[model samples]
Target: MTWGRARCALLAIPIRPNIRGRAVMAYDDNNRGLLLALKYGDKMEGVSTMARWMARAGRDILTDTHIIVPVPLHRWRLLSRRYNQSAVLANRLAELTGRLAIPDLMVRVRAT
Candidate 1:
């Protein structure tokens, strides 16, 4: 199934692309850099790639969205991890798209 369909179980819908083609969804793929970053830290290239995607995707998604809300992180996890990938992505996205990044709209109570 598509990412949109996959998210339905949680009552979440993928943000459809606006006039431009963009959607807000999780980055489920584990690129080499991301895997490294997970094991190491932001020193990996994942940050740059993730940042680029966010900016590009944000522009497309914001074409129809007045606001962008990222998948959230728990406070403890946020602190422990020292970073929220989705939030970082959203922040870069908001800057590139000129859209508001509402990071607090969604909260993650747990992870599966």
Candidate 2:
């Protein structure tokens, strides 16, 4: 899952040396619609299903994962949407995978 590959599902970030690794589930057209609906339609239940799939995709890395941190959304976007999709997924992943999830590791400085 090295970054050298054109499209690796797992992101092996060099800067974050403490964390073991990061992985992504399928990102094809099938998932795109479901993700978009979960992000914009306030479909909270999707979090569970997504986490299950994410957990399956990332099961191997879970053992080494101490915590899960999702990419942040802009403040304005968060305010309007009332939630961050990534955070939702992370939290659910935390619950299902027994790993801690930190929703906000950093700030965007300003709205987009």
Candidate 3:
């Protein structure tokens, strides 16, 4: 799968229990700005683009997906940030893919 000119890969870490994973974009110079802006600058306008990229990159996995869940933030972090970027992306992705988004499906027990 691919998004723009960036190549997508199915990431597998033998030590991890998960069977597969896919990154929407590489954390390189080309994508760093947009990622940082979305995560820290409240640049929500880019969420649609990012979610679309994710859908394209993970199309195979999504074919079998039943629900979309965002990695939750710790309570303190949630308070400080006032929003979870992952949740934003998850919601947008749900909209694009016609899937259910359970933004609160998981919770961070403590700060990491």
Candidate 4:
């Protein structure tokens, strides 16, 4: 999405503390498979590549970033999945950018 569209989309969502957001790539047919694999197929071999893309895409934000926190998964989902794709990406990004990855900083009080 264009910056204007992205901004408007973000504005519509209720996020705590209101932070800027970026998309590494559009979730189109070209990237849907890779994304789905990482998110649901337990295929993490592409995480490093994806994180690199994220670091590049969010370079501006990373310059001022102090910590990388991945959104937590619900307890049941975590149990079934055996891992959080977001945390994996966060940790990989931290390794590439020298940022701190605090995977447990956020807790999911309830399932959405």
Best by lDDT: 4
lDDT against the true structure, each candidate:
0.62, 0.77, 0.84, 0.87
lDDT of 3 by residue, 1-112 (tens): 1223333234432222233669977899998999998888888889999899999999998898878888999999888888999999999999999999989866799799
Best model per TM-score: 4
Instruction: Estimate TM-scores for all models.
Output: 0.56, 0.72, 0.81, 0.82
For each of the candidates, the C-alpha root-mean-square deviation to the true structure, in angstroms, is 7.6, 7.6, 10.1, 8.0
- How much lDDT does candidate 1 score? 0.62
Q: List the residue pairs that clash in candidate 3.
A: none
lDDT of 4 by residue, 61-85 (tens): 9998878989999999999889999
Instruction: Give the candidates in order of TM-score, highest first.
Output: 4, 3, 2, 1
Number of colliding residue pairs in model 4? 0
lDDT, model 2, position 64? 81
What lDDT tens digits, residue by residue, belong to model 1 across residues 1-112? Answer: 4434444335576544323445434456646556557434755445556656656655545556777777787888788778777676667667766778878876788763
C-alpha positional error of residue 94 in candidate 4 after TM-score superposition, expressed in Å? 0.3
Error of 1 at 68 (Å): 1.1
> Count of backbone clashes for each model?
0, 0, 0, 0
What is the overall TM-score of model 3 with all chains considered together? Answer: 0.81
Better of 3 and 4 by lDDT: 4
Please write out the lDDT profile of model 2 over residues 1-112, one tens digit for every residue. 3434434125643443344544455778877877788889988877788788788888888878788988788888998999898898889999998899979775666666
